[model samples]
Target: MFSLYALAQQAPSIDLIISNCKVINMADGSITQGQSVAIKNGKIIDVHSDKYIKNKYQAAQYIQAEGRYVMPGLWDMHMHFGGGDSTLHENKNFLALYLAHGVTSIRDMAADISKSVVKWRDEINNDQLTGPRIFTSGPKLEGYKPIWKGVLQVGTPEEVESALDSLQKLNVDFVKITENTLKPDIYLYALKAVKARGLRSSAHIPSSLTLNEVIDAGLNSVEHLGYAYNAGIPKAATASKASQFNAEYAKQQYRYMANHHVFITPTLLGSYIISHLDEDSHTNDAYLKYIGRGIKNTYSWRVDRAKNISAEASKQRHENYDNVSKILPLLQSEGVKIMAGTDAGYLNSFVYPGIGIHQELALMVKAGLSPLQALQASVVNSPAFLGLTEYGSVAKDKRADLILLDQNPIENIEATQKIHSVIVKGVVFDRRQLDKFLKDVADQNVSGL
Candidate 1:
């Protein structure tokens, strides 16, 4: 004997509900106050006024946002996870570091451990692993007998086709091409071919060609600011040849980048770390405790290279870093999309996985991007660059990858580093849990130096 009115009034069921928060809209940095967000099965089902959420829905779990600032989780667009077979476990530990720092997604630019990385990517997606969502370029493309390990070496058009065929079989998220022994023509050929196959591409623009040439050939993103900066130099049309520093040519190149809509990842922190190597030896960085021996050993070659340089050479290196960083604000003014990546991994010195992103945002701010713009580089621009439509904003029907900050990041970018909690795939990791994650990573075993 059920009342008809009662039978008709069943509340909607949701997996989790977050209440009493100010949601930051990355779309334009607006704040929707006193909102409640309902999530079901990892996707945000609805966002509404708190009263509507309380009246119409029931959830298995409730997280009180307590007037905190909630926005999409950070994304590190360029990082790596490889140090040959011996460092596999060591590299895997980086996942915990990333999550503890409120970074919920990472783009693994190719490394020597593609097989292990691809497996981990799937596990994370299927809920079998505890880590960020991984988007990887499976074993990058290289030229014949290239120096980099785990690359598909191609010397001719036929070889390029076969290499792309292999990448398709591996089901990579995108293709990464480097200039290490790769010929300029074949690099262009690979870009065009990858595009023809309907695949997205990222690459180290060959110094032999103008930046515009690669953009014309279908390169979606440039991996470093140095390359973009090189393009901005007058007649910098080619890296191998010397040309006058033409300010007009540089303006044209930047204008061209704006017109073509090319994406650029400055990876300022890593470059800055190297540029300042003369002053900061980084031998006593506290973050080094989390890095394993094998990975730390990988950092030696670059460190040695920096140390061996003469005083004049070191001065030039600092000048190069300063000059290249100047392009950041210019790119912003030109409407070029800039992605924030730390380049924090093997062979890159002192750039830790988790906390390095915050440093990157700070550097971007120092380079003339506003705090909102710096945050956008990570939360909004990274996803947009990769075309990952499921993320990049806090909205209804979006994936529940978010961060809750004690202070509004819009007001101060450093506030992002003060994370209160993180929600990954609708699962909440409160501050205590985040701290425990750091401890667990710290406690993992690594070999002695």
Candidate 2:
């Protein structure tokens, strides 16, 4: 019985419904057919067959995904956003860049506009602006006589306490610690302080501490795969002169962290850009415009590093990538959670903001992750790590943070970006909208240049 009345049977009209899309069920590697996702207000209301939804609820708006692959919006876990402080409107512009690229949440590892970024983070949560949701660590912690900008310098235990106190007052989400910037004791102390306060701690693991020590001390996450790369070695050198000899030992040490359930962000996009900065490149990458002039110029320094790296250094650099590939499957098999991060910001050199994430997915695939596994590293694993309960998976009750791909991502990960449309917060953005946004970003950057 064709009941038009049944179509309006549902009382509360859904705000949006995405129909006829192939849902990428991350829970298991299977694709589901003919499913529709319905949303009301800002939350997902239902997921079911198109016929069932049509018979049950009326939607204010309906988006036809037209045979596209639908999966969760991605998270770039370690993007630095500090360079925006040099200008008046750069931070605001940076937010726009992130949203335009389907990056729904970003972990600002450290940024200079500590208070300003916090203000924006709150504002975004309150829907004050159209920007990606933020989790920030405010200023990085340094030991003393710090070289980097916007650091909380600590010399003694008291200084560490003072820094943590200041960070809490500033409403920092977590703490990001650096090696050269912090003494080994103070570094470990900061990690403990953050843990004692019930906040998560993530950082660039120092060579001073064993990977085993950092995990034992309650570090929540490792910033980059360099930590894992170093862990794979057999004999880690403590001195600068011996530094060259111990990389293999570092790789050897990673199995220990994997055994202990330590999660790591490889941030391979940043590695790829810096590693091959001289390899003929792509400019006007659609994401470049949203970057402010100061940070945009910072990218040139990457080329210098690439050119200056001796042949010996370059060979070893590639070997690090190889080491990463060798251990990734093992890490995954052992249930060591791996999250994807781009480290996509000024300090990263060649990595661009929005565009770098796709590059990162590719590198993860290159480094021994199955295409589906690589995609999950970028999409599913990240939100889970951040504790976004209703995000990441393409299922009922999840936020409508999803990308519509032209091809099956499970078969070919690069197909993940072949966007047919984007459904975020239940708002539909078609290819046309995406193209326009990217063009606007590029034109703005070119004008500034």
Number of clashes found in candidate 1: 0
Model 1: per-residue Cα lDDT over 310-339, one tens digit each: 899889888878777877888888788889
Q: Which one wins on lDDT?
A: 1
The models' CA-based lDDT, in order, is 0.88, 0.74
Q: Candidate 1: worst 10 consecutive residues by lDDT? A: 236-245
Q: Candidate 2, 384: how far from true, in Å?
A: 2.0
State each candidate's clash count.
0, 17
RMSD of each: 2.6, 3.2
Best by TM-score: 1
